[model samples]
Target: MAGNPVVTDWTTDFDHTDKAWAADPYPIMDELRDTCPVAHSDRFGGAWLPTRHEDVSAIANDTEHFTSRSIVVSEHRPPMELAPEGIAPPISSDPPFHAQARRMLLPVFSPQTIDKLEPSTRAYCQELLAALQGKDVVDAAADYAAHIPVRVIANMLGLPEEDGDKFRGFVLHVLEGVALPLEERIVGFQQLFEYLMPQINDRVANPKDDLISFLLASELDGKPLDPFHVVRTVALLLIAGIDTTWSAIGASIWHLAKSPTDLKRLVNEPELMPTAIEELLRAYAPVTMARLVKEDFEFQGCPMKAEDWVLLSFPAANRDPAFFENPDEVILDRSPNRHAAFGLGIHRCAGSHLARMEMRVALEEWVKVYPDFSLEDAGAVRWSGGQVRGPRVLPIQVGP
Candidate 1:
């Protein structure tokens, strides 16, 4: 096993294993971007740092050169070899297969399709907010932001709303481990696989209006999708959709609550909701990293080898001086933002449209009712680890 990377300079500082930096990595990232854009880190298992917008975007967009074969940097590899991420090959083999699967999943999350769900999405957001109406202090991440995305995804996947809490527990447990104890995580994954198998079987037996049902009924290349593929695809969606969006929403709310000026601006002008979402995503860069490697050659003048893990730093990219005029500030109406928060190229997040809608609805409705909310204890905000980045606890006091 390899060891974590080391940073010897003030410009390049990070303890990849440090819990504090995970809570708010921008400061360290800024240091790195200013001094060492391509600095190497031994703390993160020996991956080079690419903090500038151009370097990160170049690596992400040129998938053929820097393949998406190992999206996570954990010490151990996942059991499911063809798990629809982190490997490149023939469509039936890896990269191509992921592309095809994405095409099939796109319709379920298309802007048009997601727009149709706006009423239900907004209603749910209001309902969740209503539950928090009288509370003096609440952990917004747990009590509100995290729950909405999972519930929405559950409904979309034909799961019961009551199971949302349980599913979230499983997701947090699986993702939090830096080096997931293989046996325990494997057992957990197996249980999840077992839990979803019957659901897929039922969907196959009797199709409905949900995603699993659509997967079961649809044909890939003249034949029905393999049942295992459907399960893997749904599993990916559940993990990615629930965790990433939940974190993004939590981070957005945390930032806004911390800034009364920004909150006041948005509350006074509802039209800024959409731009606010982008700015928040850019400022926060919630998703940790996407792992990939070169298929044949080198990157940034470094000698390349097949399957060598590299981290694509989206948060760093979002703050690159070349991309945004003032990378650190929250410009709500940041026009031509063109960020890689949802990633870039073919594998960009399939659920981005829905994610935007969810955030927009949550912000539009939450600010309307809780415009006066303020952080209960600003220093109390904590973040959890995993492929996702977000506040673990965001306590706030809401009132008129």
Candidate 2:
């Protein structure tokens, strides 16, 4: 990553993994939205970044032109035969198949279902805070924000909470390992499957009240789901479910750490939590999805080819001046906030309800305890370097 070439022109050549983009992509995205609107790059085996909300929404909704076969943009492209079901369903599923796959899990992540987990989620947050009692400064990203979703999702999947380190390793390899060598990446996938196959087998043999067992018992077209399908879906639940929410929580904390006024308002105005959560999600939205161009075609005058990667940036779309009022400013109670933080179209995040619950509870409990805190070292805060972006090393000063 260090030796990668510097970007001379954002319109002609842009690299999401580049240090500049990783550190602060807002400016780059804003400039792209103004000038190019649709920026292309040779990196990641040729990819395009559509900065405008209209284009992003169009591409996201047009399954006929784009394929979800491989959502994460990387050097490696999945074989053509993998489609219809893709590597993971329903995120990776396409068209009619995607609908069925997604419908099966709706009840699992429904509002009612996620609400039941709130008590335990709050308990865990309190436990985490309890452990940090004497700390004057803390790494919020690593110490606090990162653990909530991992614990919640781990519990949902019936995996041991102590196996969190392993889950983080798999998440890093899958989401942030875009620039990794193909062979190395394959090994990462192999390692994840190796670790999961055993758990999956155990669930198959002995059913439980968790997602894995639920998937194992599920059927498609009146036939039981395949073992590989179960593994892929579980991996999706564990990887996507954990990283996106973790990043959202960390980014929200990072914003409060820097903006004392916003932090103070949140502490004093307890009723503003719901609106504040949506505003934060709109402004610092994480998880930029990828879609492989279905076939060679021109979109908004840019020549695209089959198998090309489209970096569908919900973050960029959320900030587009054409969409939101004074988009850059984080207004806590911005009304009509129908932003695509959870994405747009049929692929809108199924885990959004769960993510919202986690963030609200996490922030509520955090501000209730440490109502006044600031960044310990602005320079020391480190952000992740791939599609899913957030503060990975956020040091906050909690006491004088």
Considering every candidate listed, which one attains the maximal TM-score? 2
The C-alpha TM-scores of every prediction are 0.91, 0.99
Q: Write the per-residue lDDT of candidate 2 for residues 335-380, one digit (tens) a residue.
A: 9898899999999999999999999999999888899999999999
Q: lDDT per prediction?
A: 0.74, 0.93
Query: What is the C-alpha lDDT profile of model 1 across 286-351, one tens digit per residue?
Result: 775555454546676665555555667788899888888999899999998988898866667778
Residue 332 lDDT, candidate 2, scale 0-100: 86
lDDT of 1 at 272: 83
lDDT of 1 at 238: 77
